[model samples]
Target: MLSMREFWNIVSISLCVQAQISQQLSDTGHTWNYDDGENDWSKNYPFCGGTHQSPIDIYSNIKYDAALTPIQVVGYDSPGIDHFTLSNDGHSVKVSLPATMYISSLKHKYTAVQLHLHWGDQKRPQGSEHTFNDRRFAAELHILHYNSDKYVDSQTATAKEDGLAVLGILLEVGSFNPTFENIQKYLSQVAYKDQEVQIPAFSIRNLLPVTLNEYYRYNGSLTTPPCYPSVLWTVFRQPVKISQEQLFSLETALFSSNVGDSIPQPMVNNFRQKQERAKRELLASFKEDFTFPIAIAFILGIFVIVAIIIYIIRKRRARQQSESRKRVMYAAAQKAEGTSSIEI
Candidate 1:
């Protein structure tokens, strides 16, 4: 019953609002999800289409930054917080961290904010964001931090260059990881979207690899949309292990839909596909070496030499035993001939 002009005006206003969705500071109000594919995110979030994106493929195309020193963290063992807020933010399960834990290895002190995970479903187990030499892991964990020295808060830091630092740890299936269970045991509580729970505080450092010295460093953006190009990424070369059952627990426990939804969607494969590294320089804290290949070659050569030595020793023993048997037979034959001659 409305006039034509009013209908057109409403359409224009809706289009205008959609255009501004990309400019929003928080993703809380947006409808971006792993569903319908990640390519759709770039449409609404302009930064998601930017060049300096994250979750890049890490392979032989990397630089050995000899100048890059080992990673050093402060107050990780004691995060100075009693309880953490674990919430399912519709996309993934996140745990809020304390500002007291800061990383001291970078140019500025980057304080801890929150951490989250990305994983695949039971059907396809591998879902890590970053790939190493084209190899994918079972899952990925991202620990987010903001530049404390230069920025007032995490939100303010998101707009600045080199304002964020993220530690990306690749997770593989193996023995049960108790540190991971501290968070996993509480995943059921935050099973639905926007649901949250309180978890006991533990050593944040334990979540990372025991040796934090070696990693791949680069300047990239946040993997999630409004993919701000402000992160200094450190992806460890070594992967941590979680039991198969534990991995299944993660893939099956959570849902992307809110509680009481008519049709619930499982929160699985909640990872963004890797973005192009584009002309960015990737740095490694450790020196590149042929140690693995060299060690394998050395071990093979030693094995071959031992096999030849054993063959020669066995041949020599067989020859000696055959010569001794021939001598005894010949002595017995000579004795029988002598007895026949004496009888004649």
Candidate 2:
């Protein structure tokens, strides 16, 4: 019953709506490992080519700033966070946290939002996004926070400078980290993208190192696409240790494709390459002095050398005493033989 013009108008409107929907879906379901012509994210995300990109290689020659305040995290051990959600977003596994936890060190208090991880396979081992002295870790964890004082929410804050603060903790393979057990136990539930499970929350502070004072601070953009240059990054110098078993779960337990997909792909090596550090200063909280481990090793080496010298001296003294006793016995025998010959 409609005229030709009306029909064309409706068709155009429908086409526009479909295009918008497709764009949204593409943004949401972006994957890291894509070989198709659609893999180039710079075309889709213009900010990927921005100057202030992240995941930079931190060098040991960073300037030590004594004025850098020690990070103070409040409510990280709160009992209110009894439950949380963990999800597999195809790229990485993310754990959602309540806004109750916040950092008080910065000028404006930043509230905690969520944390995620980046990892690599067993063959490569090192998958952390940020590196220290060109050295990468087995995995990296990022706890994202937003300036709650000025921004109403994290979404709004992501586009502004001095908006988000990310705490980066590197993970090394060593001992079993019980702090990670809660999320690891439920990783299977979220093996595929868009899958999520509820996990009992524990002390988030347990995940951080004992000393939060020493770290590398820089201003950079998000490592992911739409790389917003708003994050104030604080990567700790010390890395936390996790068992090989835990690393295996992180590498092999998750699938990038959906459960119903024709081909199953494991989600590993989700980290971005190190970007150029263009006109940025990497500030360290503490000066690079003799490390505790190095000092301990030096002391142990000294003790071993002293122990060897004492043992050699004692052996020499024992040999000399034995020779002196033999000489005295020989002289006594000779005097007795001479006396017997005289009596004869």
Candidate 3:
């Protein structure tokens, strides 16, 4: 028999999961059946039939029509309340109400909360999104934010079409990133689970891509449960790189211990299942195939028009020159005939 406290703890945790998943079957009528234990490739290796599986490649056959207006970054503040919040274990960081932030298709301002990482013992070569260009990132950072206006009241939690946004920044292996170093300074205290430190002076705006002007935007779920399909996702076309050593340090820090004693398993692959397109256009900012052809056609058309104008101008000039030369020759002939008369 469990004590009252223990029973409440169990109940509390259960309710939290239910709230996050929004009653198992999502509001859009899809069921989430992917549990880590159930979907383990070694055990469920050849059997799990659920479409909502983990580690699906991101860019697989998805073609975005046009990219959205890059979200404006108002400002970034340190880790503080309503500004920067923490997870129970400091595994995640959130920033709220980012100033001047905008999503192309949405109708509200989004507040970024915390950013965190997900990784495997080795960087999964295939990557988190099922169709990344044949390789996986060392780790990925998800910056989570919610619509401040939509959830203004407590009663509107499950409302669909609510304004929620998440920006997924893919981290690849490369040289050092200054932002990563800034984040690392806090790990000494809050690196472990349930240990959180608040640094209210770090500006998240710097973390954005210099070319946020272009990206792929789509409607997708939270990747995690309640698997809320409310997210308007803006995944950038550019990838930021971190050194292998830095990557290892960050991965190590995510473990149950700061020293990497054991693998830390929180939400290994929290990305949601790709939903039906529902006839919505996936926007890409810098489109090559479609835009390139149209641009080429436009340039050729302009060139043709300019060439015609040049030809007409040259013809007019040549006609004027010919007339002037003829008049000069006629005048010379008359002058020669008059000179013979003078000689007699």
Candidate 4:
């Protein structure tokens, strides 16, 4: 005998295998908009206004932590399932991942929950949440996970500190990528809000960068409403590439409105504006070469300034010498005239 409360938690808010693909979503049927309700998220959800927020601006001065090891996964290559449910959750596109897949190398076993995306539109394409060196990419992909060892499921893990781990893959416009195409090929099928489809499962590891050793690690929160500051963020340095056509499809393929609404809104610019990062340490697995390039540019600038100063000094000295010569010649001519007058 399942109580209605238990059933609802398992079905509506579950991100594990027993649950749906996403948790902390529009599951509450809470109406919020990015364009209008964005500034007012704190009015309804107080956590939106809280400190230690996510999608921070990763500046140049990130500290290199030696303990930040390469992220290891258990069963990402083989999902062990034929198809996974894909849905347009009115905010973003989501795909449910099985609990069989989890990250192994972390201190606790962080099981895979679901993966979703945030993107911009044809007019404004910089939709990525986390910006690196103040550069925002075209789109961003988030693979959500929960601490399986500490909590029963993701729904229970949502509120706890250090309970979530999300892998962020930033996308840029480039050549066609087949791994992303596995999900993108089915975009047209689930274009409207609440539209669900069964997309064939593929290797989740392919979604990540080829080299997992280099990444930026930080402590942040979920980018959406009811923003929980539980996520252990890992944003890869190398961005995933997709062609212009693919990016356009992501921007314009979906609608924010449900299947039947008076006015359908294009689901563009679904990303939240970055929040303030107050006194939190940002770590990197590999040391960034920010100084080498800056050092070269600084030396070149100094040389240019010195060259200009030398040119100005030489020009002034030449002009002064020319004026002195003219004065001396005029004086000599006057003296010669006086001598000639005396001889007369």
Instruction: Report the number of clashing residue pairs per model.
Output: 0, 0, 29, 0
Per-residue lDDT tens digits of candidate 3, residues 10-87?
Answer: 854653554544443345464332343333422222212222223344554456454256566554434333333433
Who is ahead in lDDT, 3 or 4?
4
TM-score of 3: 0.57
Cα error of candidate 3 at position 97, Å: 7.8
Across 1-344, the per-residue lDDT of candidate 1 in tens digits comes to 87999986774454345334655634446678888988887777877886789888998667888888888999889988899999999989999998888899888999999999999999999999999877889999999999999889997777566689999999999999999998999999999999999999998888889899899999998888778777899999889999999999999999999899999999999888888887899989888788999999999999999999999999999999999999999999999999999999
lDDT value, candidate 2, whole model: 0.85
lDDT of 1 at 208: 89
How well is each residue in 117-212 modelled by candidate 2, as lDDT tens digits?
999998998999999878999999999999999999997677667789999999999999999887788999999988998888888898998889
| Alpha carbon deviation, residue 29, candidate 4 (Å) | 4.3
Clashing pairs in 1: none
Alpha-carbon local distance difference test for all models: 0.88, 0.85, 0.54, 0.86
- Clashing pairs for predicted structure model 4, backbone only: none
Candidate 2 global Cα RMSD: 12.3
Write the residue-wise lDDT of candidate 4 on 1-344 in tens digits.
Answer: 99988886664332243222223344755567797967787666656787778899989668999998898987899999998899998899999999989988788999999999999988888999999777889999999999999999997888667689999999999999888898888988988899999988899898888888889988888898678777899999999998998899898889888878989889999998888887898999998776989999999999999999999999999999999999999999999999999999
Candidate 3 residue 338 Cα shift, in angstroms, is: 95
Residue 24 lDDT (model 1): 60
